[model samples]
Target: MTGAAPRLRSPPRNGGVRHSPETARKKSPPPPPSSSAGGIWESAHFLKWTAADALRLPVRHPIPCVLAASLLFFMAVEYTLRMIPATSQPFDLGFAATAALHRGLAASPRLNTLLAGLNTVFVGMQTMYILWTWVIEGRPRSTIAALFMFTCRGILGYATQLPLPQGFLGSGADFPVGNVGFFLFFSGHVAASVIASQDMKRLQRCHLARLFDTLNALQILRLLTTRGHYTIDLAAGLAAGVLFDSIAGEYQISHKLNH
Candidate 1:
């Protein structure tokens, strides 16, 4: 029998490299899927903790955790009270404080405008930080706890639908009266700022805390002059924020100990 003819392999077209199945199989993995819109979320994956993560979290300070939860519960009750529609039975120092601040700040339009603008900035920053802390911690329970507490605050404000303070915006009339705009029973801005501030203090306890604290104080004062929050509303908001922060802190501590 004649010797088998030698197999002739085709050369690469135009001298280009050709990869065999084996070679292709060994090729480096396809670049990871492009994250696109999820890039930001992916960057913070470290903070995203699941239920399993919570289960693994360790308890560092069980007592503080319990205490914080208790305070939060009472704050929820107080929030409910504020939510009630402006009843003849309930009283607040909003009128006096709002009027006084409005009059006091009336002379300096520039000053009032500056503070109002600052308040707007602070409110936005506070929101970002609150969400940031929860997400960064990567705990579902902590996030849920925060959301629940904040939701309570929102419900109360909407339920009351109390008119904005006459002093707000140099006169209540100046403020565009609207269903949402006039939801002034409790100052969500102040509450949110305070909560963010306290959390920062607990977590970082340095420049960040001081920054947040200053913003919180400024916001509380400005709410009366610009946001139409009553003194009682501001007070309630602060209490709610503090309570929420405490609860969140304890929850995180407990979770950490488990891990």
Candidate 2:
């Protein structure tokens, strides 16, 4: 390994899209507007779907809209709470008080591994949900911007020496798992795209992107309003992990298929 970065392969297509009877039966809807920055209140926003819409989606599979909205809220709450003066709020909580939540949930090695794995999946599933939304919403420009920003931050985990909030990047760290967060997030981000674009599987790609764009846009607004760097960073680590893992997962799948 000479530090060469892995190049991504464009997701392949099965056959060129041929409108079928089903396509012809349904009237083509009006093109969706360009997604605005996400917020719960924004009507035209690409990422912000209503609670009703989410409830309507089948829960058998993970939903990006729900995950993004939930993560964004958690980030906003935990981070904002810490900013309140201990004297005023009577809570000595720092920005990362939530990390302690992990302490209680993790038990034996098996439980620890389970939590770590689920946390990683939760992050990626959220990303995938957002991607799914973006695709549905006509592939707005904001989708690309959010993803680009996420990718840059996610890759930085490899070069940065600073102690990450999640802790477990290398070992002997507060978070023995955080060491790998960057990889999980970055790879998950790329993998989400690859998964959505897989050959004939491209059916879901458009919807996914639309959903993601709206969710991430709202997340930005939440971050701005709350200004919780630690909380946001913690949330980001999870988001980032999902992106990385998704990418790694895709690569494995692709490699398996190629061989």
- TM-scores, each model vs. reference: 0.51, 0.29
* Lowest-sum lDDT 10-residue window in model 2: 167-176
| Predicted candidate 1 versus true structure: per-residue lDDT over 1-259, tens digit per residue | 7998999987776378877889888885977866787876687876677887665544756676778889999999888874536544334455455566667787777776666565666766766776776677753433444565668877987776765444346432222222234456566676676666666565666788888777777666666556466677778877877777677767778988999
In terms of lDDT, model 1 sits at 0.65
Q: What is the Cα-based lDDT of residue 23 in candidate 1?
A: 83
Q: What are the per-residue Cα lDDT tens digits for candidate 2 across 1-259?
A: 5897989966645465557768757867877775655533466464566787657765644677668789999999888764645345223133244445434433344544554454445446555544654677653332453455456765665565333333321222212244433332233333333333331133445665565544444433222222222343535544654454455445657777999
Please count the clashing residue pairs in each candidate, in the order shown: 12, 55
Best by TM-score: 1
